[model samples]
Target: MPQRSAVSSATETERKYTAADSGSLPDLAGLPRVAGIDVDTVELSAQYYDTADLRLLQSKITLRRREGGDDAGWHVKLPGGVDTRTELHFPLDGAGASSDEPPAELMNLLLGVRRGMPVSLAALLTTSRHRHRLQGSDGTLLAEVVEDDVVAVRGSDGAEVNWREIEVEIAPSAGSHDMATLFEAIEQRLAAGGISRSFSPSKVHRVLGDLLPAAPELAEGARYLRDYLVHELHTLDLSDIAVRRNEPDAVHSMRKASRRIRSAVQTYAADFGLDEALVDELRWFGRRLSPSRDLEVQWERLAERVSEIPVDPYREATKTRIDEYFSAKSETARIEALAALDSQRYLSLLHSLDTLVDELGKTLPARRRKSELNPEKLAQSVAAVAKNVDKRVARVLKADDPHERDERMHRARKGAKRMRYAIEVIAPLHPKRTTRILARFDDFQDMLGEFQDSVVSREHLLDILSEQGHAAESSFGLGILYRLEGEIGRQQAAHLEPAWKKALRSAEKLWA
Candidate 1:
């Protein structure tokens, strides 16, 4: 087995300006800080890698191994907010680093977009960099500005391009407001020197421009669904990276993205001709992610419920027992969830999702032209979902038996969730009409969610009670907690009628 390099990640925010090869450096010794500037020079050689089709580049992701800079190593840069990118770094001399192949772990981060395609050397860039550090009077580093003369060669054709670009990057110490002002000042100064902002996102992008993917053009009618699907796919990709990093709330986010994609696809199935098999696979993927997020939510909720015990000793005891119980459960669930994500099934699902998005983007416009993707037809479909939710709500209210009511309640919650997501997908078309309706459904779904949570909590508490080894005090506290969850469930159930009624009232105006 090949040893993988340890990876570290950080968010980088920077702006780039195209400059003429012979342009003199702009004088920045009198910017906002008006202090001395520190300057250094470095030579760098970098090898970029991506799929044969440039999948990573098309997704605005870049992977490269560079030597000669202070931070020389293999780097993966992920797209972030405006003028920002999240960078993952691996040491050059780390175990698997000798080969041309990227570290397996870092490559894994690209799986969502790579879709199991083999990556190869895409470009080679060599840069001579003049680095300038702008500083505060007390020697604080405010920002680093670099003038890079870069030569890039395309790996496929060995076609070479040379250019000079100036990059301004804010330091961690730079205040947000101050950084904005600083960038403005620097841009003005650069503009005075005849430099303009670069159109290319990166040096490699410019070198491989002809091979990059083109953005799909959507018809007016196809725009809403297409945009929503694209946005969700991007979220899923980002969340996949976050999960691989094991960042906080990563599993929850990935799960929610999966749900959003599944919901949107299911809701708009008729309009887009999405595959049912893909939906089933999405369901399977989401189920795999559920255990970790479920355990986390249950633990937090039960820990909070412990405070309602009203006795100091019992509350603390209950808290400790719940915490300990959930700690073990959460760890196991997290390990399982990550393992599932790392499996081949998850990669296949990603590939299917990628295919779906590509197909939709390419076909929706033509479908709209045929009137097969009518907005009214989409509205009617959502109305059908609303009707189902209403029927389920009615059943929940009329059920007499406790077990039947419990079963009916679960169905109602699921129905409400589907309705809310349906409205969310179509809200762009009827924003004014759907805003209040979505709010009501949000309230309805939240109440149902709490009720369902209590249901699950009570079951777990019962299992705890049936076990043999707990201290009498701990069990006593848990017993009280079990009862409390039952009471809470009843309270939530009672509130359900008014909530659904409010949601129904707002929904009535949706198609009006």
Candidate 2:
């Protein structure tokens, strides 16, 4: 309901290249399952727009209004990688299709990037394209290879530039075709011609390189932690986008990102200026996301375990109760979480994260070289987390009473998660060893998670029975459900020991 009209979007996955050699054309003819290569050509023109300071460019995003070819209108491209971008399109508005002013909906999508900055015309590009389409035997389109001759003019500066490149666009929705093989074969043909892949992100980047921000100069410890923080922030942003679209697993993914961000700051706070208040705020954000995610987990779990209940009118009544509760709780939780994300508070938090790396870079900018990394110091910092994991795991293993064991295992799970995230940060430094250590502890954490879930499920099931009020059949069905959950818990308990031992041994070796 944010927009009156639908926001049309698709994943744009394509590779751009400069050359494909001169001597002989590659065998781009009919390959396996391919019907033929159909050739055609077209002329395309686009006007790119952005903030005066190039805020959108800094974020590797582009908003353009174009004419010609099959798809035309205003397009917003979010750069994901060398060949991946999330593209959203809106039909051209009648008032000013080529006006400096952007559509209101497109402006809304760029709020996270623009942060209230004013936008204007950045550049204009025109291309004469010769396209080759690969199609399947049944006339299904596969990929489009286009040779583009381009001319670009900067809007403000009046500077002009031109270039030619080959762009291979795989039909992202097509999975039945062997696109990967076709891509590799194309690359091989180009490689044989002594053509190298283009390094520029896009034609716009090539023309306006001076406007983009320079890479941060960072210290060794700062480098590791900065990358960790940026990654978590990226996940956080992506998850928020998914949640806004009402996509699956968005809340869970967002929660995990918040947790990872919190853990990273806790593990290496001094490297950045991360303090206690900020950590508390992250925890607050995670808590806001948790209610929705937990309700989702409970709803799915109770439905799954209903099979264990004895088949009777009691079972039917329980199912109805569960459904009604789930419907109300889930709707409220979703609304609450979305409301928080759209609040000014969340927007301010995002703006703060926008310059997180550069701000950290200023802390210890003196050491720019790899030789400055103190291996012994790095090892000690890593070992501190590993030691914490070991202590928690040991407490869980030693606990005798059920209550004591559950409490210890809960602590152990949190510690293990923190350690696993820390290891992932340093995995490139010690890939083989860290990979082994991570797997062992991850298994241990997952087992404890299942055990804890079973405990909560049992209580919630009992609450359902208690609400039935004087119904004998309901009590009997609830008893069966509770016992089944207890048995499941026992099964998980049986699977825990070997994983614990394996994790303990691996944790010790990580420090070794």
Each candidate's TM vs. the true structure? 0.92, 0.83
Clashes per model (N, Cα, C within 3 A) = 0, 0
lDDT, candidate 2, residue 200?
Answer: 83
Q: Give the range of the ten consecutive residues with the poorest summed lDDT in model 1.
A: 364-373
Cα lDDT for residue 132, candidate 1 = 93
Residue-level lDDT tens digits of model 1 in 1-512:
63443898888889988999796877887899748799999999999999998988877889999999778999999998998998999998876676588988787778777877889999999999999989999898899889999999988998889999999998878878898899889889899999999998888888997886567777544666767777777778788888877788888888887887787788778777788787788889888889888888898888877877877877787788788778888888877887877789988888887788778668645444777666666777777877888888889889998678878999988777777776777777778888888877788888888888988899888876776777777788898888888888899999988888898778766565
- Candidate 1 lDDT score relative to the true structure: 0.83
Cα lDDT tens digits, model 2, 43-103, are 9999998888787776677888888998778988876754789888877753334455677
Per-residue lDDT, model 2, residue 245, is 65
* lDDT for each candidate structure: 0.83, 0.74
